[model samples]
Target: PRPTQQTQTFIPNTSGGNLPEITSELLNSYIHSSQWHFIKQLAPKITPSLITSALLDLHKNPDLAFQFINHLGFRRIRDIKTRCIAIAVISGLSTSKPTLQLLKETLNSGIATIQVVFNELAVARDELRIRSSTVFDFLLRVCCELKRDDDAFKCFYMMKEKGFVPKIESCNDMLSMFVKLNRPYKAWVLYAEMFRMRIKSSVCTFNIMINLLCKEGKLQKAKDFLGFMESLGIKPNIVTYNTIVHGYCLSGRIEGARLVLNAMKSRGVQPDSYTYGSFVSGMCKEGRLEEASRMLEQMKENGLVPTAVTYNTLIDGYCNKGNLEMAFSFRDEMVKQGIMPTASTYNLLIHELLMERKMVEADDMLKEMGEKGIVPDSITYNILINGYCRCGNAKKAFSLHDEMIHKGMLPDIVMFNALIDGHCTNGNIERAFSLLKEMDRMKVHPDEVTYNTLMHGRCRQGKVEEARRLLDQMKRRGIKPDHISFNPTRLTYNALIQGLCKNQEGDLAEELLREMVSKGITPDDNTYFSLIEGIASVDKAAESSNS
Candidate 1:
């Protein structure tokens, strides 16, 4: 017979629970025989306090305690103390999966702050007399997985403060998160902390640091880091070689990338698809298309299949160079090689078609995309929207915009800019302003092109004051005119000056020309022409008024 249910010996953790009491012995008996259905019958009688007491009684038997917790259900075990004790029991098992999972749930539940959870975990760990740091490590692992860097850092240093050195894997997890978050300085700080704590670094750790260095444009430092890892007896894997190769290629140093490639090959590390892909991308960027094609062939000879990205790189290069015939040929070759075209592939081809003003061909490509069941992503829609806008088809462009939204795709700033430019081109300045307002409502911050388009539109409508105000608003929003692409900026200024001059504001036009020059933007011939024409007209007006 089961042990008799005891009288209420423990108070509830919360006011709502008036749970019937079952002693640990009875709970333990029901759990021992795998009679979970019997224990579950007492669920209406169960509270966090009862569960914690039962867990403490079964601390020596973590498996049964875990089973009991699972039977009662984690959702019922809502309190922090109960969850923490449950986690501590699970941590006693050889595998950390259940422990990590429970900790992740606890953290994600948002019922308790990370600090409260950590505090409870520490207390539970000490009460259970478990000497392993597995629970803390799991906590950090969960934090890293959640991308909660600050919480992970708190848990890490908290463990260190309590004289518990986290394992290398935990440190690496946090380090990897910091790198992914693009917080390089924080990553380096954590690395230095790891060094100070004498936690041995792993290949994964060194790889993350190398990636960080490459992202920071310290390619040489990244290479030297490889030698540093070797000194520490950690061998470089294929990922290590690929990282440096990618960095070199991205920096336009083909010879440097080739040196790394040869070094990897000498070390018996055969180049993979990514290794060759970098070279293909580099060669394409340098306009060596034929060589890139040959490299793709070389990749196939080495039993490596090139990805759609590799082919897309070549197609984009050809498209940029106005070689549509070759671009289409490569697209056909990819299909022949059994590599189906991705939405990106169709996007590239359709974009090029539109760039060549072959609207019919572009539409045909879009139809092919649908036939292949390749759904158009945001880039595809942006391409088509911009294309139709350029062709003075605002009605069609707007129709596509509605279709995009109906398809659950949010219009990006590029789409908005294209629409604004189209409205401006069609002399629909009021509609352009409406779009700008819509951008504000959607919280899409306008870039320089956005403001530039509006400013030009205002100038075109002879609203010179409003145009000047937009430039001021742009400055106030901290969006500077793009100095790299000075032509558009120079055009904006010329339009504004011409508008001012037409309003017989020659002095303001000259002042703006001086401002343009002072900003190191040379006044082009159109700039000088606007000023000259303005001054001549103003002089003629003054003489006519005197007559």
Candidate 2:
């Protein structure tokens, strides 16, 4: 709260009206007064020049200026000059929050670009004789928080060019934003820049860089980072160790993870749920379910409560191994342990149930989800939509599709492929084609699965020419069938060859074989069988024509 207004004698202006001349002293008096309504009454007389003068007058008392600006409201400070002056004044206060708030408001106000604000703030800073670069540092922090990484990067160098080094926290924020955006390369460049600038890094900075190294699959380098930190006399924290453990686990190097675990413990850094969870997940990935379960037991014995992620990892393992009994047992155990199942937990169970062709059970599980207040996410809807499609009930699949969209979930490529496959299976080639057009309108690029399904549909309808055109279109679009590693290119060639053979287009089928071989796609037994059938059909047609 501002101090009460001091009783001061005011001298009337010779050319002014009944109100006294509004000098900086009078403005300061009104600013410190508990009666802000008086200032509101004098709003008409307040101009940008008056605000700038008053800010300069109250430069030594930034708190009063901040309050005065707040009472003036951002709308009144619409001009870029006044706003920057206001930001510069408030920046002198001991707390950064008020200054940051004002700066953010100024930038978001659209009165000036970031560059303009940067320049104006510098001018205002110089006019006030404020030598500190705190205001510019706050600008970088705000830009980073707004996710304007490129703009922030430009501003960073700009500040540096002006002989100003932003505080280390601002630099870390920039690096962290790059990591969050998955632009590890940019993060590295910026990291090197920070090093060159001699900006000392914090533990948070090292942690973020370690995560980046792990993301790039440079696990060995990630481990070496701990040594680098130690050499610099910086102690490693729990997060640092957990990141490396997780990295090793992600690459299926369980032994490497074990070494890290032992090292962390020997250093008196105890393993938490996340640390143990990584091991469980890695073991599950390697099909060591029994070992993963035993690890879970050890985690519990250590008095570390397992997170939903831990339980979910175990459940997913069992689901993959087709052991629903064990999966459900873990789910029940988690609920009994007072850890409510997350949407992810339910999604896993529902996906496995659908994979087993048990639609009724999947539906029941979905109902249970609503009862338990577990809102279904996009993954949940995709699982249900796909299950219904596989069961040949396109109506239910489409109905679920509408529901998911209504719930504000955008259907991804996987869901679209399922819908297209469902339509093709039901002999609705025209509808499938329409969906393909919809994909284009929605800016969802159709992948090879999309073209493969469409080609197979056209072949089923005996529209061999359309299927062949689809193959050509696939080539034109540069859609690689094996872009998704699990989907082999052979499946694509097989679909086209079988379609041509069925339509008695043996010449086209043979041509496709040659093309497939030229692309280094070895023809499978199905490919040869389709070619032989095509040849036999062509021979029969020729004989019949001769007779």
lDDT of 2 by residue, 1-547 (tens): 1122322222212343355356556666777674577666666556566677778788998888887877767655667777888899899888999888877777676778888999988889888999899899999999987888888988898998999987889988998899889888889999998899999988888999999999899999998998898789888899999999999999999999999999999989999999999999999999999999999999999999999999999999999999999999999999999999999999999999989988889999999999988899999999899988988889999999989888888888999999999999998889999989988877778888898899889888888788878877777666454333222378888988998888788888889899889988999999999989888988999999999
Question: What does candidate 1 score on TM?
Answer: 0.86
RMSD of 2: 6.1
What is the TM-score (0 to 1) of candidate 2?
0.85
Query: lDDT per model, in order?
Result: 0.86, 0.86
**Residue runs of model 2 more than 4 Å from their true location after superposition:** 1-29, 41-44, 75-78, 110-116, 150-165, 183-199, 406-408, 472-493, 511-522, 541-547
Candidate 1 residue-wise lDDT, 1-547, digit = tens: 1123434432323543554567667776777788987666677667566677778778888888778877777855667877888899888887778788888888887879988998888999888888887889999999999999999999988999989999999999998999999888889999999999999999999989999998998999999999999998998999999999999988888899989999889888999999999999999999888988999999999999988899999999999999999999989989998999999899988998888899999989999998999999999999999999988888889899989989988888899999999999999999999998988888777777888888888988888999998877766666344322223367678888988988889989988888888777787888888888888999999999999
Candidate whose TM-score is highest:
1
